[model samples]
Target: MASTLRFSVTFLTLLFSLWVVEVHTSRKLISIKEEEDQTISHLLKDGEFDDPSLYMFFRINDLKYDLKSGSKLPIFFNKDDPQKLPPLITRQEADLIPFTTSKLDFLLSHFSISKDSPQGKAMKETLERCNYKPMEGQLKFCGTSLESMLDLVKETIGSNADLKVMTTKVTVPTQNTVSYALHNYTFVEAPKELFGVKMLGCHRMPYPYAVYYCHGHKSGSRVFEVNLVSDNGRQRVVGPAVCHMDTSMWNTDHVAFKVLKIEPGTAPVCHFFPLDNIVWLTK
Candidate 1:
């Protein structure tokens, strides 16, 4: 009887060990794929967005994140390449630590948003696909992820909570290069009391736009944008496709928000927002 009992115990122990090993192996494999995809996406930020392998903007129309209340993303840059923009005045910088899934869940809760929500889930996945914070010591996100980063000089002199991104990716005409500029990404903060909790929300801006602009490309029937976050989502100017830059807030006829025009003229235009058309809501 004793020998039989010992044999049964040993058999169960072996089964449990195999199960543990299998589980660990499965997770490690998943993480490996995650790392590979994340790195490729980063490299692709400097490549053509129309590449068949990229899927960032390919599902733009299907991308339904909760932009109604505003952004829930960790504070990052408006561009992958800040050099493409005009030189900064001071060029502040800082090191950002990665926010783990648990951390994201905690922070998002303050906004009355759930990390498990449909949009929340999408953001989580997006964050995984990109390196939100730096690893080791080097800053890989400096010029690509964000144009500039604010120093964490915790001076309690301003608002208790604040986050803002006023820049966006754009294609420079004539030169035929991809770049970014301010698009009035406004952030409005209440007294931190929404649903009995603090919240900072987006206002008058599209959500993390980087892919999909339609203009006459010198190459191929279709021109791809570099650093386009998504290949599925795109914006095209209908009608005459006349473009220009107008900084005046009064100019509603302007094609883009807070941008310099590639071509200047008073040409009739019909803009299509198949992908990025988010606007600020006050109601």
Candidate 2:
């Protein structure tokens, strides 16, 4: 009787162990699915261009905090005239008027006169004497011109003690083979510790025979797709089997490879062949 009891207990323990493993596996699969969903959400929210073929574009760069806050001057210009312009105040500007009321109100009240009025003509003459160009066509905010905004902001911020702003220029290749600006903006603080803040407007492309490094926590499946499809002939090696090999074999050979804790999702996989075998495949 005692022997029979022992056998039953052993069988129950084995069954319990199997159940635990199965549950753990299922939970891992759920977690992976959640992560994939979050990635897709981010891409949808931040991507502005409508190129369906593009996998992803860099996020828009904006002025950083270090830069002198551009005179958030509220200004307007005549749509038809193109030159004669005036400033329109926003709610934020109105609230701020109390703090800098004397200077702001003086500028605004003087700007109220029409260009054809005597006082307006006198004011225009005075501005011209002071090197202020009567902005024709529109009464727009006449702080610094947009063309020089980036540079002016950089210089202004760099002058201050607390802030340091630098600019990096990256050239991106267009489909027509011409290179165009990818990012240009003043940054307050570095976005990433290693990589300074950037304003990007280019798409990421995959290169042939190159392995992309990915972190263990959130795998870059979309990035992998971009890399795989970059070469027209290399598209076939990107599905389930290849993804597995990329995560396992190819990663091991490259110095960039880092071990990832994969749950129930597919592993990025790669296969490497000897030089002779590679020649055979190419032939």
Candidate 3:
């Protein structure tokens, strides 16, 4: 009977040890699953652009912080006059404007395409084979201008090896903050010569990307749309964006523009805009 008692005790001890091991393994599996979910959230951090085709960019549109004196102003043009001129921005005044961009640098780029790599070689090759026949009755740029633009790209883009030389961190817009600025705009039409190719209009939106202080929590919400009256009295509106520059617009009724609220499901092209700021965009 003593031997029987010893066997019973040993069996019970074994059972307890197995139970402890099972519980530890279950907890470990749960912890690993939780860690994987966190990593995914980290990779998709910050804002998500609504249209993936427009290109990824970083923007600084906060109005409170003073811009650095040496920061270069974004290129923009006035559209009200017949001459179609770009508005001038001095470095000092540009500092007060409260806007910055990384959009132009990636006009036709992908998130995976880094500036410090030779991947641009493929783009150059594609350009070489690009069908660039000028159309009838279209404004044609001089061959010299076309050649130079392509040559410049071949010489400068994607020639480097390592991209980690500079660190790129995501800029998170602050919640509930307001922004104000002069909504400058440019107008343009595609010529028959460059009908298919994507180009930033000289008088249109020189900087198509923008940001505001509100609506920072949502992934891809835009603050406002810009509008202008055509010569025929028709109103023209650019969705999710407007350019600000020409001081002449305020002086004359020739340039008609209005700020329209963007609706849900529309692609707002701006990178920054406000959410629920009890504020005004007068400037």
- The lDDT leader among the candidates is 1
lDDT (0-100) at residue 63 of candidate 3?
A: 16
Error of 1 at 163 (Å): 26
Question: Model 2, range 1-109, lDDT digits (tens) per residue?
Answer: 6755664465355334322311110101100122332322322221232322122122212111223432110001001111222232344443433322234335436
Q: Candidate 2 local accuracy as lDDT? A: 0.23
- TM per candidate: 0.20, 0.17, 0.16
Model 1, residue 257: C-alpha shift (Å): 35
lDDT of 2 at 222: 19
Which tens-of-lDDT digit does each residue in 1-283 have in candidate 3?
Answer: 6755664465455334322311110101100122232322211121232222112111223111122221111111111221232233344443343232233235335324544445444333323322233323222121112223222222322222210110111111343211111121122231111111211111112221111111111111223332221222222322223222222213232112111122222222232211111111111
Each prediction's whole-model lDDT (CA): 0.24, 0.23, 0.23
Question: Model 1: which ten-residue window has the lowest total lDDT?
Answer: 22-31
